[model samples]
Target: MTVTETSATALHDDAVRTLEGWRTADAGQDRLRRDYLAHLAGHPDGLFRACLPAHITASALVVDPASGRVLLTLHPKVGIWLQMGGHCEPGDPDLAAAALREATEESGIPDLTLLTADGAPTPVMLDRHQVRCTGKDRPENTHLDVQYVALARPGAEALISEESLDLRWFGYDSLPELTDDSVRALVARARELTR
Candidate 1:
């Protein structure tokens, strides 16, 4: 009854197409895009295994349209304020669905939806960052993250999840100063997309 053999293949194919169709001028992102495409071509199970040298992750920046504020979760393992997202699960249909699912689960806002362009979920960003590995023999891992911007329903209540130390919204002009360049870049791109 393992779903990976079939569903995982479809999701991987969809992810490949999504990455191929994304438009970007950033050199680093372009590199990640190429690397992700290569990884998918090389590893049939790349979408599901965190133990792989590199794997696909889907995440999103959740913004409250009425207030112009973005929600961030204080990640317990990483110890930083970040967008709601994580590794793709078996039930996710595609990268965008995985991102939306992560946003809903992490932000506790089930009504969250992607900000679409021409009625399609346009990729807002791609990031590749090293993370401490969970595998028994691996010391580190890489995440090829497909990022998106999702709009949260106004007055939606956010409950702190087990994965987060805290959850809060910050105005665009008033984000915390300690976040890394990737988070800042994601927020900036998300703001531009919303505008």
Candidate 2:
């Protein structure tokens, strides 16, 4: 394998190990975790967006516990408020790093701390949904998303990137009405962790 292929393979191995070790009280979360693992096993390119059947994506909810605010990006294509994340790049060292990088790049916030367990970054939830990876209309494939929580420093200013139509912080209790329940649920669970 070439250097790029080797790097991606390493990340794929890391993802399998991470998901295998993750546990949740929620049955649906655990079920999705298994499904993700199976997908990775069945398709070597499961972690890449180019995998058309489905792909393992990483995303993080940027939260400021002290202020009770969560940062969300209005997705340009979906035209709805969502977390900072996308397709896993070949260079991403691991799922958590992919989530962190996406959060930083999209939020323009620095020094965010990932919520962790057992001295390692752990997932807050799993959300599998259909999406058009590109801005084109209609569902293209599934995004089997491994969601994590990121703690943003208080009063961290957010700058919107081209990937987002708009980026803003909303109180945990007052997320945008247009925001879907999955994101709201993510914020609720993230609040529980930060507490």
Candidate 3:
């Protein structure tokens, strides 16, 4: 294999192991985890391709430590407040790196750091959600999201990205009413993990 090909293969291997070994109390998440692993086993390009039946996504709950608030983006396409995340890029070594990169990029917080335990950032939640198919949209299928928690630098400012209509920080107890259950669950899991 060429160097790029080998690196991609190694990233796929890491994803397989990470998904296979993740533990979850939620039966739905557990099933999605299995389904994701199976999809990867069957499809060589499953990890990075957006048009797969279900593709792996990496996301992070960006929390401010001092105020215990979470940074959320108003996703234009989805039309909902959601965590910072997107499809896995070929340059991402693993899910955690992908999540961190997405959080930083989406929130425009360059100093955001993944909350780590035992010196390694860990996955805090797994989610599978359907996306409304826009004409010829890339991710017309479900998203199998591997979620992590990140901390923003104190007094950090957020710049809205073109992908989002707005970016704001919400208190843990007072998240926007339009926030979906999956994102709420992710926030709860993030709070638990970071604490």
Maximum-lDDT candidate: 2
lDDT of 3 by residue, 1-195 (tens): 887677677778988988877777888878878888988898766767544566778899999867778999998888899999988877788878999999999999898889875687878888888774433445368777888898987677898888899999998889998889999998888777666
Superposed by TM-score, candidate 3 places the C-alpha of residue 156 at a distance from the truth, in angstroms, of 2.2
lDDT of 2 at 21: 96
lDDT of 1: 0.85
Clash counts for the predictions, in order:
0, 0, 0
* lDDT score, candidate 3, position 108: 91
Q: List the residue pairs that clash in candidate 2.
A: none
Q: What's the candidate order when arranged by decreasing lDDT?
A: 2, 1, 3
lDDT of each: 0.85, 0.92, 0.83
TM-score of 2: 0.97
Pick the winner on lDDT between candidates 2 and 3: 2
Report how far residue 37 has shifted in candidate 3, in Å.
1.4
